[model samples]
Target: MPAIPTDAVRVADVAARIGGSVRGDAGRLVSGVASLASATISDLSYFSGNRRGIQPDKTSAGVVLCQSKHQDALPSGAVLILVPNPQSAFVDVLEWLFPRSEPTKCIDPCAHIHPTADLADDVTVGAHVVIGAGCRIASGVRIGPGCILGENISIGSDTELIARVTVMNHCEIGARCVIQPGAVIGSDGFGLINEQGRWRRVPQLGRVVIGDDVDIGANTTIDRGALDDTRIDNGAKLDNLIQVAHNVEIGAHSAIAGCAGLAGSSVVGKYCTLGGGVGLAGHLTLVDGVHITGMSMVTRSIRQPGVYSAGTPLDTNDNWHKNAARFKQLERIAHRVQALETGLNALRKNDEENL
Candidate 1:
């Protein structure tokens, strides 16, 4: 684990870094960051919303980052940085306080690189990494320990593949991307045809193309297409354990949460969000700005941009059983109600004719 910095920063310097103004004494020293509930006099904490149920008066933080709406809620003599977006500004401050160390630019002796492989200056190949023939690694790229790159793979500049990542044949990873550990890119898609009770495997000839600034989570598996490329567009964020099937096109800036499964050939439009455990059937389309809640199942195409959800609310087992049993009798109940209405109408007509 990397050590946290012991150095302290002035309250005024932190405000200047995030383009905010200091409200209290600017000379106070902030040595670390902590949560609002556990803050001390040496720690800086932030309050962005009331959803966390934080009490501002109980906090003993040296500095607090907050929006203008919550400034009056703070205790007296509290040092503060007022920003438009406290979360984003706090992220910037965190990055400024702790920067990542650059890896040494050298190929490990135990690694196997083919003679025909091309690598630019300043590339770092870690221990036991296997680079097949015709692979191209650009400058400032760090291939971590035990990574395997298949033939004809192209990795762009400044991309970091943390330990044990596997990129199979002919795939292309764009610049400034962070692929977490155990992510398998360009694996064969689940394409099979049934022939006389035996499964015949279809050839996967396409690649998995990842765009710039993409962050793929740990253990996420992206399959190669059967005939075309499976693409993840720029700035899209995919969480852990996501299964992106063959030929699926995820639009730019779309975010899919953990355990979400997108079936083959599904086109997700830009800025869409799918919550955890959401499953979409094959060959469907979700329009831009669509939001699907957690554990929802999408069975058809969504042409309009809006929030959609489908799942039964939870209930006790006894009540659920009664409701479910009544639900199964709906067709029979409707037929009986229609017959009763018809008989009543006939009786009313006979009485009117006699009068």
Candidate 2:
């Protein structure tokens, strides 16, 4: 393990680096980072929302990052780093204190690369990585251990593939993309046919095209298309365990949360937000600005832009049983109400006839 920084930075230094104002105990010493709930006297923690403000007074954190509006809520004798947006400032501070790990320039002997593969001068290939023929790996690309890149693959500059990422043939990934471990892109789509009562596999003949600045989470699988390529637009962020079927087009700046499944031929528009566990049926289109809540089942196309929810919330055991029983009798209750209305109308008609 690398030696942690022991020198405590002055609160003024943090404010100067992140362009924030300092309040209360400017000379406080902060040596490490911690969460708001478990910060110690030499650690720094941040509070951004009301939900996170419950235990600030009880925390022993030496320094606290908060917005100017939250100054009154801090405990006495604690240093306060006030910024316009505390969360953003906290991210900058964390990045400054703990930078990401960069791989050193070492080509492992066990790595295999074809003679026709064009690799840049600064690229790092880890152990057991196989780069196939006619692959072009641009500058600063890192291929981790056990990765397999098929033929005619183009990985743009500054892209990173973590361990065990498999990129099949003829796929193009743009610059600054981070593909996590166990993510298999450009695999054959799920195409099968029942020919004479026997299941036969259909060959997937297209590639997977991923755009720039995309971050794919761990264990996510994106399949190649049958004819047209499956396209993921720029700035799209996919969370872990997502399954994207063939010919799916994800627009720019869209975010899909973890465990979401999009079937084949689905078109998701730009700026759309799909919550975790959401499922989109095949061949459906979601227009731009659509926000679907968690566990929603989108069976048809959504042309209008709004927030949609489908799944029911969890209830207590007894209340859930009662509600479930009531739910089943909803049609019978509706019929009783209709019968009452009909009897009242008949009485009113008799009175009118007598008058």
Candidate 3:
């Protein structure tokens, strides 16, 4: 059985709800969503043309969401819903069918709240959560169980801090932001000064300022700045296990994938995308719309807007070793070539003189 409950919905009604146009029978009834390969006659499905082994003509789904290019490929028995973004429209259908249950606005009895902390009347604070002094929580805010909020921290309206999340002192989170489980915000920067044989720790005096509609993934650690604030602009999405070092300024609408690490003082421009395991060295900048491929290490600042990739491609172990050895002898081989060129030049001069 499917985990999601199936509902009898009309094709035209769903099209109106998702802002799409229907090409076939609008009166057709679809019960639920499924993939093209597994769709039944009563189900709805989407084809994005990128997935392998999924053909629109072979699908048995009654209602389908797809682009105009793939509409002709649909079987005559199926109903095609024309949309620019098929995946997004499918998600809208899912939301329309299965509405999320709203959390009750009530503070848990086991939670701890400081006397100076300010909370809205409709805020929800869960069990074992701690709200420190000078903290402000806006309306429609939900703090999940086992969360900790430090002093002078302000959470905007409708922001959700998921289970076991920690927000340290002087941090601000904007409205409609979702912080996933185990995320640590406003942690101290790794600033240390080497004095003789001893290392002196520098105080991290800044905060993390997160903008509205930002999504921080689980277990991601965003360190506070050494002096200024570490800022993540609106609509920025961070994947799980990402390390954002001190004073990193991530521009608006930038998406960073899992395990990506940004060192201190790095600035990423707006609409930039960083693939998984990408590393940005300290004090560098990336221009707008710059895309870095997975596992690439960026040491220099990027001034252009295009997809960039580094690191060697995969090869056999023996071939890689041979290539590495050859690369090491190039300088010596160039000197020998230079010596032969010099001797050849001397002989050519003597022949020309004799002529």
What is candidate 2's lDDT per residue for 120-192, written digit by digit as tens?
Answer: 9999999999999999999999999999999999999999998999999999999999999999999999989
> Which pairs in model 3 have colliding backbones?
none
Candidate 1: which pairs clash?
none
**Candidate 3 residue 122 C-alpha distance from true site, Å:** 0.7
**Full-model lDDT for every candidate:** 0.92, 0.91, 0.94
- Between prediction 1 and prediction 3, which has the larger lDDT? 3
Model 1 segments more than 4 A misplaced: 1-4, 326-355
* TM-score winner between candidates 2 and 3: 2
How do the residues 174-201 of candidate 1 rate in per-residue lDDT, one tens digit apiece? 9999999999999999999999999999
lDDT of 3 by residue, 1-355 (tens): 2224456888999999999999988998878778888888888889888567766788788788999998878898888999999999999988888886699989999999999999999999999999999999999999999999999999999999989999999999999999999999999989999999899999999999999999999999999999999999999999999999999999999999999999999999999999999999999999999999999999999999999999888899999999899989999999999999999999999999999
- Whole-model lDDT, candidate 2? 0.91
Give the Cα-based TM-score of candidate 1 against the true structure. 0.91
lDDT of 3 at 281: 100
Candidate with more favorable, higher TM-score: 1 or 3: 1
